[model samples]
Target: MRLFFPLLLSILIFSCTTKQKDHFEADIIIYGGTSAGITAAVQAKKMGKSVIVVSPDRHLGGLSSGGLGFTDTGNKAVIGGLAREFYHRLYLHYEQDSAWKWQKREEYGNKGQGTPAIDGENRTMWIFEPHAAERVFEDFVKENQLEIHRNEWLDREGGVVKENGEITSFRTLSGKIYRGKVFIDATYEGDLMAAAGVSYHVGREGNSMYDETWNGVQVGVYQHRHYFRDSISAYKIPGDPSSGLLPEISPNPPGKNGDGDKLLQAYNFRMALSRNPDNRVPFAKPANYDPARYELLARVYAAGWNQTFEKYDPIPNLKTDTNNHGPFSTDYIGKNYDYPEASYERRTEIINEHEDYQKGLMYFLSNDPQVPEDVRKEMANYGLAKDEFTDNDNWPHQIYVREARRMIGAYVMTEHDVLGAKAVPQPVGMGSYSLDSHNTQRFVTPGGFVQNEGDIGVHPKQPYSISYGTLVPKKEECSNLLVPVCVSSSHTAFGSIRMEPVFMILGQSAAAAASLAIDEGIAVQDLDYEKLRKVLLEEKQVLEN
Candidate 1:
């Protein structure tokens, strides 16, 4: 009987070993299925390299399809290469008469980002529906013949196998292993970068750290119309400190103007809403909806704040890409401080909390009796688009991760590079967007009123170049890994560099460098910049103004 039991145990061990022996090999392994990851895979294929994309998301385009249809493109001329091709394809899709299924082509307005939505001369479209954007990304994958494994999450705890400061392979939560010569961490959260023992920063760095302005906590500087115009009491019973501060407002005083803190910028879902009665799904109350949580918004409305519909930016077919607007609106400030480094279970909780809060805000404005009558009437015109995000019950599947773990690599992009005061060596791409950041926290001011802080907007003198060194890690950290989404940058500089188009550009450049490194048998940090620049220019990337 003992001999029989030992033989059974041996059989079980052999079966387990056989199952774990499967490993997929490639020249480059892209760890995200974001827009950047797709672009990187395409570029690597174009360079005659075998590549595979391991995506944690089921969706293709990150935020481009996840509800942020209103693109924040600062200067369109600087957008070239595959990024420009993506917008061009969007233009082609809208040219077809059948594309306008919900609304007539003539009825849809052509206004977006201070330009016409359909630019016939430039052959590009800036605004579109969520479904249309997703179609384009899927088309890219199909046309490129790229291999993508979706819904596969990386094992954050001890999943990365490294040998002498280089990643040999990585295992997923499902026990699937991928071996590659090079890796690109294209995720917005920088999960692969963090797992590979790379140095990164979480919260806002003090202005003194980079020796520039707008890098740290911003208290009194109000750059947009998001703050409260008039002083309003934060208490439940108005002006009585004994009643205690209302929900969502922090009791702690906002620190001095420029002092830094561990707080991060607020994150909210960019909802895709429709005004067309046929396509609109009325905002349903979330399962965990609580009306008392939005008491501060009711008070803001009572104080004559009525900008609820200001940010209902228009897209195609009468759909709107709705974002956070005004004081006490959608952004749940001070609630995401621990999200960057939290466990998967904790991150899911945070995402669910944001979804519930935003969903509840919509219901409160459209039906709550305490809300102002005129504001409620305006909000009643909008609802979730029935044709978008169908698998997730008409809600976006991806949350807007405004900022996350930023790698501190060989080169750190600071405010000097963003403001065009410093020359960037080994230029890979360009960014012209304003240095924009959302509010990080809502706290009581010294005057005993609620105020939102950490919002800053500073524009560059001209389109500035991003360095290639920002994409690769230091020689001592990891030799084969490249990070494009969370590139090395100060808080203020990353604001401008964090645009979607810029991410695509860097992704392509990172793949090009990776291919060159493999062909020359060199580390990513030791690749020839001149050769990379020649290839990037050949691919139509705009490196210099």
Candidate 2:
């Protein structure tokens, strides 16, 4: 009986070995296709590592391809590695006559407004069209033979399995799994990091958490021209709550500043707009459009507001990547509070609500009788770009999920980091954008006027060093994970780190870590900084100075 039991155990062990060998394996698996994801994949290939980028996006580049073809690059000189290479490639594309499908090369000029399109020489471009940016990422992947699995969501629960402080494997909702030596959570949401059991944070921290003045809500602060016009009525028409709070206003209480809460930043679709009648699909009345919903905007207009439709400027091909312009603009604030961690079904509902609100705003301004005639007539001249986002009813499938779950790694970057309080020793890259935060909560002020809090735009004292440690998980946490796009940082710190070009820089650095970890067969946390720094410099990652 003992001999027979031993034989059965041996047979079971052999079967398990066979099953384990068949699981999908790669040197690195990136879990998002934002600009950061694409850069990480390319860097992995440069190091001769087999890689797969499993992206939830049907498209590759995140906002860089979505609608912000106009890149928000603060210090253009600091951009290096794959991020700079991307803009150089964009320049080469534009240098060709055929690349200008709509506008003449001379007509293009410098179109980034205040932001520089070219450096000392006209060899690099900082901004471009949406399709061109996507093409650049696609071209890079094709050249490198990097495998990309589009429209795949990482299963949050049990999707990632770690063994002895290293990520062993991660599975997707489609049942496909990927086993990698090292992994990067390049998604803006930091989903992979969370799934791997790493600690993270969300929403604003108090002023004391990081000694940041702009960490929490600041009501009645009108930084941008996006408030109600005097002619427009109040939330309750100066008295009537029975008339009820405005449509987009939240029912929940607006929490105090310097208080920790789970309020999410406002989100909006980057609309591709055009004036060409042949290509424009005139702003149609959304199916669920309601005129009364825009009562806040109506109040603004009644106050002689006229700053609408000012953001529909030109991109390549005579198209314009229209962003949110002013007060009560396309940004659907206070409606997406539950979205950061909501289920997929709930996320869809929130997205639909935003779409309805934004579309209805456009429709009301263009067609409703309540809008000023000049505003309506002017809005009537614009529509969604017919060629852009054709499959999803002229709407971007990915909403501008501005901020989400940020991993709390070993080092917590504060406003002091950007302010140059302490020099980061393991410098990977640099970010110079202001510690900017959009509105978080809207509330009735002591004076009875509705106002937004948590919109800060304080400039950084200098271009500060961003540490490589910020991108890596702690030694105690999962060691093989490198998070570039959503690296560990405080809320105020993330405000600066969240920029696209900065994300790309971090992506390159993360990939560098992955390659080094593989060569040494060590955890990502313990990689030799000397070797990593040498490789980054050779590849132009800009470690220091």
Candidate 3:
């Protein structure tokens, strides 16, 4: 009896020490449940590798499935592989008559007539509802038999374990450890990359840093129609400086043109709203609603900036993927400067504040007496989609983190690459979107008029190749890590590469590279470029033409 008891005690101790529930091992460990993370896991599994997806959020597909149903697809010819497959699946879903729940299929097609969902030659539906996109991403995971651990955030401070400048494993806030031969930082924030001690950059760089035309603080360059057409006062009382600045306007001078600053472009939720009364949930007044917060927008309304409904791009089932539009619209200018490096708690606060600001803006427009009668009555028809984001009160679970920590990897892609001035040495994929950046700050002009700074939208001459070196870290920093979402690129270059389709393309390429490196028993930096390129081509990845 004593011998049996001792054996049982030893077994229990061994079980506790070796087979811990918190420890998970795989061939590749991907952080972030973004579009990139899902594609990466699918690719890794396709290559006969075991992969685990550790997502920071409960829902998958980051911005793609969040609320960005209206895709920012520039020159859709360049999109290939898993990214294209994703859109094709959406097309298949829309083909089913049962897919249209709130509205008739004929009604949606008629409204979305010119949009690619019906007009594209490839038969891929680029426009979709938020829930439809989420379902496709979920299907990818399920079809691949990939392991996903959602709502598991990384412990950025002291959770990473490294060996000789190589990431061995990382722990989450839940004390769960993910050990793998290679790791991919697919999060928009690059939490895993920073935690693993990889070098990265935030904010805009000076024009001289890469001899680019648009990189730094562009105070006067208004490329799109997002700027005010007429003069608007910054003060509460027109032409009275003593009246103080209206809400969301800075009192400081806009920075010099082409000079570097730590300013980040504004961010807001990409709302999936509906006008159908049967399927619409009215925009609620936020718990912290303040009428004064939208005074700038009220002035914008007074100036006849009537483009509020211009960006309510149509999707399936009579829904719209509404985005930021107009001079004083959804973009919360200058409020997210610290978001890339912010702690989880601080980021949550920032996100909540943005949500409240946008919510109140909607409510104010629909109900406030300051808003014009025509605009207010028109806005009253719109509301959040009743069937979308059911778990999160019909609000988008993911915020649009347009740009974040960009890794300064083996190659730093600059405007020279994006503008087709420089040649790609080792092309892994291609991105064709325009170099676009939203306003970074809103300040009073020297003439006492309100203005926005740092919004650039220069179209690239042609589709540009994404370099392989942009995915891997420096050999001395981390040998077995890949950063697909936040690749090595300048602020101006990233403006083009930050699209959801591009992220999915990069994710697939990064996973393929990682899988090859594991098979070759070498660091990701040491993998042969030709071999990786061959595999990517076989998989129908669109590189340089």
Predicted candidate 2 versus true structure: per-residue lDDT over 1-545, tens digit per residue: 99999999999999888667535789999999999999999999999999999998899889888887667777777888999999999888877888776667666556674665644384787767777888999999899998999988988988888888888998888877889889989997788898888888877777777777767666655566555434333456655655667666665666665766777678888887766666678878888777887877777777777777677766766677787766677888788887767777798898898888888887888887778998877776678877777787767666788888888886778888887778787888889888877777666654456666667677877687888889887889988899987678888888888889999999988998899999998988888888988988888876654
**Pairwise TM-score winner, candidates 2 and 3:** 3
Q: What ranges in model 2 sit over 4 Å off?
A: 1-22, 116-120, 228-233
Q: Tell me the tens digit of each residue's lDDT in model 1 across 424-470.
A: 99999999999989999888877778889988889898999999989
Better of 1 and 2 by lDDT: 1
The per-candidate count of clashes, in order, stands at: 0, 9, 0
After superposing candidate 3 on the true structure, give the runs of residues whose Cα lies further than 4 Å from its correct spot. 1-11, 14-19, 109-115
TM-score result, candidate 3? 0.97
Which one wins on TM-score? 3
Q: How far is candidate 1 from the true structure (C-alpha RMSD, Å)?
A: 2.4
Per-residue lDDT of 440 in model 1:
91
Q: Model-by-model lDDT, in order?
A: 0.90, 0.80, 0.90
Candidate 1's displacement at residue 204, Å, is 0.7
Give residue 152's lDDT in candidate 2 (0 to 100). 86
Model 2: ten consecutive residues of lowest lDDT: 226-235
Clashing pairs in 2: 226-327, 229-300, 229-303, 230-303, 231-302, 231-303, 232-299, 232-303, 233-299
